[model samples]
Target chain A: MSHAVHSPARPSVSTQTPALEVHGLGKTFHIGGLFSSQAVRALHRVDLTIGRGEIVALVGESGSGKSTLARCVARLEKPSEGAILLDGIDVLKRDRFQASRTFRSQLQMVFQDPFGSLNAAHRIEHFLRRSLTIHGKGGTGQGSEAQTRRRLEELMTTVGLQADMLDSYPHELSGGQRQRVAIARALAVEPQVILADEPTSMLDVSVRIGVLNLMRKLRDEQGISMLYITHDLASARYLADRTAVMFAGEIVEEGESLDLLANPAHPYTQLLVSAVPDPARAGSYDPVHRARLRQAVMASTACAFEDDPHQRCSSEEPVRHQVGDPRNGHWVRCHLYRPGAGAGGHALATEPLPEPQPAA
Target chain B: MTVSQTSFGSHEPVLDVKNLTVKYIGDTRSTTAVDNVSFSIGAGEVFGLAGESGCGKSTIANSIMRLLKDPANVAAGSISFGGKDVLAMSQDELRRFRWQDVAMVFQSAMNSLNPVLTIGEQVADIFTTHAGYSRKESLRRAAQLLELVRIDPARLKSYPHQLSGGMRQRAVIAMAVALKPSLLILDEPTTALDVVVQQEIMAQIKDLQRELGFSVLFITHDMSLMVELSHRMAVMYGGRIVETAKAHDIYTTPRHPYTQALMGAFPPLTGPRVPLTGLPEGVKFHNIPDLAEVAPGHFVAPFDADAEAGVLEGAAQ
Candidate 1:
């Protein structure tokens, strides 16, 4: 909705491998008493990819499993079943120490809470130096010392923090400053892919925009790929090149951010877009007239739209229906958009059940 | 209903606060959380407070409720609601004043709901303690309150875990309005809910306010949500009210650079998209800018008048 995160055409993308790829991701959490095991399906065959220098936002609500997906990609929580390839390396398959270090360093994450993720005991210098040392970019040799110091200053300046802040502890800095330190730490490794889970969600409005702009500037200047996850669609639209609307652990829609926002095909996406409190429409919002929430059905055999129960929706899960041009196409998952699917089901799906005709 | 409710002339304000200041006393250093903040809410008005974390919006809300935690004290201020002095009230009067006169609905306040108690029991408990109602009568009133919030009255038998997040929030709102308190202070009420659910809850609050004639003090970091839901708003920065104006003007023609930045912070749902920029590099809250009024009922705190004049003029058009 704001600045363009996508730059002009680079070297042909088809020739280069994707920066990060996740295939058939499934995460199951076993809860309840030990005697009575219960499987809570957080992710269901979810697949996501990030090309070189691309930012893909995973948008969803509290229980929509977006956080779980991010955690899985970060390898903080091992996936129940899936394969993750970071910079063409099998992230899930490799062992923790030596073999995986190279690939693991290719990815880093910025968490939601700047306070919780950062250690209060450490100064800005500690975090910056620690990240560099872990990635083998630190040391005190004639060549390495000067290079490391230059890198530290560059990282701080890139995030818009003053070099004087390097000596200050996390508690002394403001929320935005602390977050800048976090971003600096993420960039210390010069990671190809940065997984930001609600990075600005905890920040104030003015500070949030500053952080968003910094993120965009980083991607534009350094060409770092990012996975931006958030619950706010507007912020996501502002920052992401491509937007994926996730509901109940499945992508309901994915497309160019602006196009998807302008013409949301999925009922859930439409509801989300419409729910955005329009300042222009102040004092006249009609929440009652909007699309209501529908129960989720992640079962592939059945359509995800539980309210609009059609024969096809019940019998088979609706796959992505291509809309618009292929290069910048809009894709939605709903039975109503399927070819030859008549207007025979619930009106909620944009296909109203046939109204009875009066005698002419 | 837009007219202030005071005496026969109907010119006095409903909830009038003046120079409300709060400070958190640490062992070594005492930090001022809220300083010289002043505003008022009309009989049927919605006054909004917009600011970031530690900016003292919540501290002001808590101080108004006399719910300040230990180590935090309301240093100076006068909070009078419908002619009753809030600061001077006795402990018993404060207890009665809390729910019966002014009630608060907080961010994720639904979590405060007792897990062991039924939704109906929680509402009934409020009645029994606050209004001294019988068990049966309170349950009856509780059901009506649930219905008021568009929730099924039958769900009153369910526990906190049984209800959805939105439902639990609505239930908390229902409890806040159970006595039809004259004023309801909602501090980031729907920040935790989904955007759609948030819209629904705000709509419910608006409808209830319209029907019950209770003033609302709404606070959030969201400029768009604040503009739509509030009649008038105050923008707080570094524990001070940096700007104040009509909700419409706050969006369409904000005078303050901070307010302008706040409006730009949220990407417009509709309208020509502009790159979110113009907040100068390395600007934080500590720098106190002078708040000035260039027009009637509009206050501003520009970063620097000469430098930001271009933005102010642009926003005006």
Candidate 2:
């Protein structure tokens, strides 16, 4: 990795109320025929929190439920069961108009694709002014039009864009520039919490860090709490304070960014970390070797259940138990962590079975 | 540059570009899309072109394929490929050479597949256009091409939407290589997929190239992935080649300041902890430095000759 996104050392998490809190979140979609319904559980009692000014990352593969979680928090999709508290306000309980207006100011999102998210016909200034006008922060009195234009210029500058760019339509800008415009539009409202889902994936490599650095700056200067959702672990390690490794709608592990990356506790997390294409490794992609690796990874699956363990753990059905140093805030849910658990072992509370040998 | 392939006694590159510039004539004034850029790709080697958005990476790719149309116009320079200049080729010749000699896989081109058509039909379309093969023969060759990409022949009948994203990408790549084209141009081939899928696609591309002895002009923003795949990589900035070197030197010790800043900007999955730093303010490629050859094979563009020479001495070891 030639260029990387980094920040100055941040202070450790304090004992203050979280900026955003989610508890026992669950979302289900009905599939198949109406009468013969099949419940596809998108989220399964997931729990997480974002400390003030901390960038918490939710890392998961596609179809692993990261987007679902983001949508739930954004209240774009209502959760079937769970509570999301943003600045002590129950986001779900608020009336439609009140929530829409408040959400515009307090919570905002930058989407995955800049091309799809931004309108092709509108100039950059149109997007900048809409958020301000719609959210009732369109500036007051004394040639407010000039004031709005000035603010638009400032927003563009913060995102490393020139003032002349305001006249350009979305299609006229590059992927990175368009993304910067999207971010500037989000910031026009001065949102307290930002949810960025794969913001840099669609952009060219050279300009990706420019966007990431902007988010870090927002976190440091404005104290905006961000929920960065992505499939890339390197980005998660770089931009997050706390990393939550999600698989099959459950957080297999959560801890300090460096700690989790340096020493991953879960099998899935370890595979992900190892799978990174390290340039240092010569002949890394030998055809037979990669095929073997793929086969091995696919062979591994979630351990099946024998009996229920507890209300939340058993009622909801856990692949394993959460065991680790709760004091250090490092949590791991896998057979490796359970007491008396070994390779391929079940959770500690469950009936014992013969342990399998460590995987080669 | 090492110029390992240059020993064949050809003073000219297999592909030579000189003072190449492109502009897009929009509704307003013509925008200089690609400045006076110059670079070349040799035979049987992967030449990576790395840059960010608006850095004119894609413009270079499109120009090489003769795919740029409408608003885009090549203002200057020449592109010589396979002993014939590409810019000078007639529409009919360009079309003939497109798949038979120089094929291109666009950024997310796999996603552009016709959803209604089966994977077999897509591969057959290429064969039909280039070789005028019969349907039965094309189907047989399609199954073989699918096998080459590690996908089962049974999937040839599946629609584009039915196959997984990875499979769809493989099908597109398979089509590009159906005729064993001399050069394959991949523009951000795996940007949309997950890491695992990205690796899978890259590995397939690499294996196929090695087996077929076809050259690749790989373009991406991911330096790590580029390093892993390419034999040599060129860093482009403001429509110019800032640095070019063997993949090893480019990764371990980059010569250019822009390359250095870029290395510092990306996040690594497994490596020593380097505190992530933000892009510096008011930094411009032309304003800050000049590019110079620091090592035997690596060249870095710095603002001035003195600074370039100074950095070169430090990098000599």
lDDT of 2 by residue, A1-360 (tens): 111222233234332557789998888777669696656677767889987778988986666678989998888888889888877667777754245777668889999999999888898889998988887677888889888888888888888789999899988888888999999999999887899999988875656766777888888777778999988888888878888987656677788777788877665666566557778775655545433333332333332222335412332234444334444466666432221111121111011123333322
- Predicted structure with the largest TM-score when compared to the true one: 1
Best by DockQ: 1
Candidate 2 chain A lowest-lDDT run of ten? A340-349
TM-scores of all candidate predictions against the true structure: 0.83, 0.79
Which pairs of residues collide in candidate 1? none
Q: Tell me the DockQ of each model, to 2 decimals.
A: 0.46, 0.30
Candidate no. 2 TM-score: 0.79
Model 2: fnat (fraction of native contacts): 0.50
